[model samples]
Target: MELLFVFLGGAIFGTIARYTLPHRDEHGSVLVPAIGAVVASVVWVALTWLGWAWDGGWIWWVSLGASVIAVVVADLAIGRHRVQTDAALLTKLTGSTATATAH
Candidate 1:
């Protein structure tokens, strides 16, 4: 199905985001790609519901583009938040401002 192609494209974009972004080690290998695929699926469905033709070229562009943007944003935000939270936890437990080592 065309949906499968969209999912695959989204996942590929997500994989790129995962490896290209910092703090990749903080999250599971599947997380970024999964997020991408899901976002792409959601976007595609939403567009279809809005009356966009499934066979339209623009639909695919928008869906996959949205997925890539979502993946990168989410990856960056989650990575930053995890680092901050981990550092805070470490500092609390150790009674020092010790930071986590970057991978």
Candidate 2:
């Protein structure tokens, strides 16, 4: 179905967004692409429900565009959150004795 194509396109860009980002290794590969595909699918469905035909160009564009944007933002947020978590964990494990100036 045409929705498949939209999802596929979003996946491609999502994969690109993930692989192209720094520290991508910190996260799972499937997560980013999965997010992209799902977002695209939902967007496409929403547009269709709102009267955009299946073959409409705007539907395709908006769906794919939002998916890519969401993927990138989500990827970045995950990476940053992981980094912060690691830092917090390290601090906790090291105990309060190790302050910022301890380095």
Candidate 3:
């Protein structure tokens, strides 16, 4: 089915985008692909229900576009959270503690 193709394409695009991010190691392997598939599936279903036929090129375009966008936004949010968390941990651990000895 065309919907299947669109979902698969979206998954590939989304996964690539996520993995290509600067902080790819911060995320789990499945997170990007899973979210991509979900977003793509949801968009495909919604547009079809709204009368956009599966055969129409717009259906593929819209679904895949939404999936990519969702992945990008998710990456930004997750990356920012990781940065903040790391900064907080560092601050807590290095609280101006220093030792000095007079010779």
Provide the lowest-lDDT 10-residue window in model 1: 94-103
lDDT of 3 at 29: 78
Error of 1 at 97 (Å): 3.4
Q: Where does candidate 3 stray beyond 4 Å?
A: 93-103
Which of 2 and 3 is ahead in TM-score? 2
> Which whole-number lDDT from 0 to 100 does residue 49 have in model 3?
92
Question: What lDDT tens digits, residue by residue, belong to model 2 across residues 1-103?
Answer: 9989988988998899988987698799899999999999999999999999887688888999999999999999999999989888887887754574586
| lDDT (tens digit, per residue) of candidate 3 on 1-103 | 7767877887798789887876677778778877888899999999989999888888888899999999888877887898889877766777632411221
Off by over 4 Å in 2: 96-103
lDDT of 2 at 43: 95
Query: What TM-score would you give candidate 1 relative to the actual structure?
Result: 0.91
The model with the greater lDDT, 1 or 2, is 1
